[model samples]
Target: MKATNEIKPRLDVVSRAITSIVEGVCKENDFDIQYSGIESTDGLPVRQLPAIWDALKTAKARMNHQMNQLISRITHRWNLASSIHRLPAEVLAIIFQEFEPIPGHPDGDSSLLNLLLVLRAWYDAITGSPQLWRSFGAHTPYNIARLVVDHSKALPISVDWRPPREPPKRDLGKVLDLAIENSARVKSLTASVPHEGDPHL
Candidate 1:
């Protein structure tokens, strides 16, 4: 949660602190804050005392927290340095609109949506671009269909009701309702009977 300005310096400090302590720690398991530091658990002079144990526990907790912070700092740096991060959100939105679904990808837009969320930038681009949500089909998953409808906002949308399967789709009714609810913005519609006994049907 630290700002970039704060994170860079703090990360350097954490890295230095970790490097310093790692030089002193005798082993990975032994965590002690004694002046001379703890080399090992076997026959450690302070191991028998409660205060020493408390100090070690605190040290362990501190190390764990620091490790977590280190990971966060690294991730923050990675995101900032990533090539995708260099692309503007508007450009990402345009890219999303131009992208086509993979051939025979069973999950359709669902997989694309899930994949786009890996980066904060891509997620924002997809969710914030109403034009990207302006074209979808009745067979889309209910939740995804809703997202498309809601995110499309006042933009005109094109609906495809051509079924992908024999039974059509279970969510067809819900998708129809969504289209009708936003009928004022429905600029284009495509639907037809399955054509009984048709080979593609």
Candidate 2:
């Protein structure tokens, strides 16, 4: 029947009540139990042990559940009132753009993808902005490239399709082929090939 805010104050009262009941039972049984030796105590009757253990366990579980609920409520309220959450979606989109990694970085796509996991608002803002998906790096995978092209929604795109320095005989033609397929929407392109003298070429 009480509100969530009132539950915190009641925790202390519940704790004290449990302590008083425990101490009363110990006193009535004339048991001089030490904290570490509770399990070894033979002075307390076996019938009372189960009741005492069950009461402690139930109290611990209930208090733990309440604590978790309170923490979740606090976090939810804090996020709702946070400045970043208050920003307009356009502003958030610009912020996401600023978080974009420099081209050629091996973790560029993964780093940008992390921004999408931050919050629902951020995910919506980034996904709704076509400009964010208009750039592709050499390290970008073909499937991800396709996703970006689709999300770009007819907007001009930039591609950086540079071959790695050392040749492992790996074929990059598929990546380039996809890039070429999207060439109509290409605004800027950077390509690198092995030097003519290089045997890997």
TM-score per prediction, in order, is 0.61, 0.62
User: Taking the tens digit of each residue's C-alpha lDDT, what string does model 2 give over 1-201?
Assistant: 888566555666765665665665565555545432334445667877776666667767887898899988988788878899999999987877876644553545456678888777788888888878877756676677777888889899888766555452233666678788988888887777767888656
**Stretches of candidate 1 exceeding 4 Å from the true structure:** 1-39, 44-62, 100-111, 166-171, 195-201
What's the TM for model 1?
0.61
Weakest ten-residue segment in model 2 by summed lDDT: 32-41
Residue-level lDDT tens digits of model 1 in 1-201: 977676455666765665456434423445543332234344555544554456556777998998899999989889989988889988877777655332222345445576475887777778888877776675676777788778878888887776566455677688778878888887888777768886656
| Model 2 spans with C-alpha error above 4 angstroms | 1-66, 105-110, 165-174, 196-201
Which pairs clash in the backbone of model 1?
Answer: none
Error of 1 at 175 (Å): 1.8
